[model samples]
Target: MDEYRAVALGTSFMMLSTTSFIGMGDIVTKKSLDWVLSNPKIGNSLSILGRLMDDMKSHKFKQKRGHIASAVECYMKEYSATEEETIIELRKQVNKAWKDINEEWINLTTIPMPLRLRTESCTYQ
Candidate 1:
């Protein structure tokens, strides 16, 4: 899919997974006050991956009966790609998101270590 739609889907899916952040353990600490609480790309990657995978599995069944449009729909509409191509590209996105999360784990962040562990636990659950 096109770059713009890909980013939009990721970000939208991130927002859609807001429940996943409920266990972020609050981020008003000095290090992780604003950006960590507000715009956490590393954690968002997990949500994006989950959303894309879910959409890939459920889109065809849902769309056939005129349910909500998914990331698959957006990609197909934006890039004129077939379902197989869209799913393949989405799988690539999911893989890249996992890599991003892995990289985030390897690097130290401004985020506090304890809250990081909580975020990890939240995702794992």
Candidate 2:
């Protein structure tokens, strides 16, 4: 979305959301929107981390053609680091993203629960 420039995770997440509105409609439609709008950090971090990972995996193929600038490229440019160092930093970023995801998900429990709770809601016979 940022056109080969450094992009925030929220923008990546927005693009991801566009791909499969069908699936996301059911999953991230309502409650998720509240949190996403209220505190975009969670979703942004997820998408940013995911984008870095995706770019890492596909950088070789993407580099040859009309691919957008990935996190790797952005980081290398920003930090003036070698490819190896950029990847190491990106992986560290992914780990950090997971930690952020865990924290947000746990905190978001205060919102409307997922439908999965219906199953567990049943009493033991």
Top model by lDDT, which number? 1
Count of backbone collisions in candidate 2? 1
Per-residue accuracy of model 2 over 38-109 as CA lDDT, tens digit each: 535555666656667788998878888867777777778878999999889889978998788677656656
TM-score against native, each model: 0.68, 0.66
Best by TM-score: 1
Candidate 1 colliding pairs: none
Candidate 2 regions with alpha-carbon error over 4 angstroms: 1-32, 115-125
The weakest ten consecutive residues by lDDT in model 1 span: 12-21
Clashing pairs in 2: 4-69
On the 0 to 100 scale, the lDDT of residue 120 in model 2 is: 17
- Report how far residue 98 has shifted in candidate 1, in Å: 0.7
